[model samples]
Target: MNHAMATPTGNAAAKITRLPFLPLASSAVAKPRNSSRANFYKEVLESARDKFTRAISFQSKDKDISLAKALHYVAAEDEAYLAYNREIDAFALQNERSDTSSPHDAQGFEAVENMPMDGKNMNEWLVEIDAIAKEVEAELVSRDIGCHLAEVLEAVNKVLFETRGFKRSHVVVDSKCLYLHSVLSSGSASAILLSVIYIEVCRRLNLTIVGSRVGDEFLIWPPTGNPEELFKVTSGRSLFGIVNGKCVDDPRSKASDINSSSLLGLEIATNRDIIGIALANLIRFYWKRASKTNYGLMLTSPLRSAHRSEEKFSKDNCSEMPLLRPQELRLAIMASERLLILQPHSWALRRDYGMMLYYNREYEAAVQELSICMAFAPEEESEVLEPFVEKLHLMRLEKSWKSSLGQKGRLTVT
Candidate 1:
């Protein structure tokens, strides 16, 4: 454990302190769900709750325990987090028709509570996702002779995105439904979210289609160029592995040994990376909301102008942003907290948390987090936080000055 990992994690309501964490499981595979998907989610939820209850009770029973005991407590907390997160995802499907707020509804704290991952919702989601995956599988299965990779690609692009009318959201990328249910319903998503859809389909089919990150752009494997080259790989570790079937990465093989065709530009996005990106997208949405000093002014932005004109406003929020202009930093703060939970050693995420604290006017906490971020950063990336910490100190001083002035002004008024 690093020095920073020892810090106790206090919630937003608690004073700023170090948050202790369990080592992230390299891969926490979801247990295979029964055909009864509803029961599967219910079982997961119950299991998580039982583990949480046991952890607390077990601690009480073994009060004078060792470090390992304390570790057990942390493990249980994480297990609960895993289950709760799934339950939370289901809430996204809640009456999209009734709660027809603008896709760009400046997500706040309430939105955090909306993502539920219960049995009922999980069943619906699996069915929807499978509906798309099954067709592609059937197509591939029918072709006993190897199907051309272009044909496979065309089938995927056609069924998932084109036929279903999935498109990248215009102007303001609304991340409201980038997850399973909402994405299927709205068919509007970002690149990473779409990649998830693609990846999931590939997983079902045992294909090796992966999400690739080349600089700023996110691309999926097997690019559209040169249709002649995209033959479906049979056995023996071919470059273009089956997308929806088993992942056959030659773990022992060197990069030099692998086929060049497998390389899709630079970095292949990991499962952790994909999940982290989704959380970051939500955080980005909230961060934008926090940055706005005035919702009235923001409503006038050209990005949202056409949307404004297209719809009539309800008496309450003008049907614009139901969750607009979060005055408190709750959503952003929560987002940063989740990011930290997911990617603890991530200096970049720590910096994001530091900035969130800065924006929330928790100057001391902000400085501490930035300091930790600086410490955690890799040697090559060490300078990333030098300028950040300096700016934070200056801001702290300025905040002190402002506080003094405010106190003096209040005294004078009195």
Candidate 2:
């Protein structure tokens, strides 16, 4: 824990100290006479702490407390985004007040806003990764290891996998394997996360690491003119072993099995795509768990006409399943919301979000979101979503009527 304190200014002369592992704590203090700002800051701090607590206290099947720590990473990424925007706004304000501006200031702001918000939390993990990279660089310098791709790859592999014991986790669905922080702490991660770590470390070493998606898997390597030759040199493997669609097994018998055609067939994944993949995994895991519960299916079921008696909505038939905790469903919704932030125009994602909102019994929000989805969705998708939006509107009205009736009954009794 770094014991750094910020020098207070003007009316707000109270010193602010850093909290261990949480920079948001420093924002607890606010300018004097600004109650709204103070309240807002307080809310931010409390929300972050609550999220962190929930993440740490999450119960897992194997009694492992650390398994659900990815929740914290997700929350941290959101906080990082908010912090980034705050900084940009502050900088712009400062420039405006100073009456000094650069030719590209507005363009820079627009570019920043347009950039994908993937891996905003990478900076939090980079400090440790940068240290590890520095160690590898120092070792290479000492051993006279030049910047040859193979030599650098070998050194990085030894340091990360051998010395540090970082390896690919067999259980890809586990939350522990999906997040960078948990991966670093547990010494095991899924293929994508391991690739992310590798990419980050190589970035620190001034080596470029590019990723490509082959089927469902993300594989990364150094950029080279002769990719096949480089694959042969690197033995057609990465830190996670053979880079195949099914990352777990090595079915290739020889180096020649990795041909130029297969390598060229790989579709390059942008940073946004990688982060989307990770969130998509989380959505799958949470949704799968939610679906096992009795009421879970109803949340996503399409609203059918009253003429279709068999598929009609009925509250009597739906019962809460204790096994499917609300937190799990909420986590799935949170992941979906974050993914939507990255790809705001994705009507399919918006539809999913609206469905999840419906499941959560937020009928008004569900109707609003699904209506937006209808506007951008194709004709077929829009048709399918129409009933859902209408049903949600009806549900909202019914809820309001019930509340009003309850109030009227109370007045009559009084």
Candidate 3:
């Protein structure tokens, strides 16, 4: 129980306070001369510049929260990229203006550089979480809690579960449980999110809590302790064990037999892996919803044989799911893409992404992705993927041909 309390690391707000302002105007250096195309480029750059400037001010400072924010931005890549471009444009603009601007203008620009970015809507959850951790820390200090591993953990549990009322969501498909902000507000989250909260709060208290994926459940324990001893801690027994349906009656005897093997089987999750798992869960949830539609039917159905009815793609039999929400497919794709960013070389992930694109009617991109999968996927997987790749190529060709015919018909009408 005589555990040492580690030194507290600076939070996101503290880090933000130390970061210098981004030099926005410096990017306006290469102002394009007036022309239709140049005008378009100029407008785009200006818009992107403005958004990027705004986005930078709101970017999350905490690592895990930032990754969650990144997942949110995956579906909005166009906006994120525009914001990125804005940062570049601002610097160019500022550099161009610096030489000709008067002393007063220069002074004003310098003053702008010192101002902190607005911290309102974008990832405000980071601030709220920081506040939660601080509150826990203050509580522990005010009560004169010792640095014993069990004591600090009990204190954390009291603040989070009893006072704050955070609980586990029983519904497996609940999307709200997957998001950090939703979990914070709703007080119910999936195991991974709860573990994240537990880890983060403990981190602020100078304690280390590490997580492992045990079977389908994510379990956490202090970095240094007897696994069974820590498991006896009330929070561990109730919150982690019972919630996961792995609780045992007797502490020492049954706990050891059950957890001993689980302890050995535990695959320690890195921060990146945890984020990837969250996105994977989202992909699964969205895909489940999407699969009920004709457009997403391929996910549940077997691949069509090469000789199977050509009438499948005929005008009267076009694959369309009027009942399916397009947003669900897009979300599944975005979640898959975000997971890929964390694990780029995973051919299984690439294959899933390719399939999502195929269902979304992006045949060309699907073909490209599946082709990559075919190249690297295991021979067995490649055999399964080859048919999708071939079908996508045919679909791409048909789409192009139809487009050409439509254009010709339009010309004839004109």
Top-scoring candidate (lDDT): 2
Per-residue alpha-carbon lDDT of model 1 for 314-358, expressed as tens digits? 222212333434332444455456556557778777866776665
The Cα RMSD of model 2 versus the native structure comes to 17.7
Candidate 2 lDDT for residue 232: 50
lDDT of 3: 0.56
For each candidate, what is the lDDT? 0.49, 0.57, 0.56
Q: Residue by residue across 1-414, what tens digits does model 3's lDDT show?
A: 001111113452244224332222223224444323333333443443453333323243334343434433332332233333454455456567976432121112121112112222334665667778887777779889677666667678778888899886646666677766667777888877887788777777777777776445667777544556544547446333432333233343233334544665667777677777777888888887776645445551434443245524332122642345555676677667656656766878887787777667777667666666655567766666555455557667778998999877854443
Per-residue lDDT for 378 in model 3?
A: 72
Best by TM-score: 3
Per-residue CA lDDT of model 2 for 190-281, tens digit only, reads 77778777777887788877787554556776767776655452454543243222353445423234456566666777666666777887
Candidate 3 runs further than 4 Å off: 1-120, 232-261, 292-323, 410-414
Comparing 1 and 3 by lDDT, which wins? 3
Using lDDT as the measure, name the better of candidate 2 and candidate 3: 2
User: Which scores greater on lDDT, model 1 or model 2?
Assistant: 2
Clashes (N, CA, C under 3 Å) per candidate: 30, 0, 21
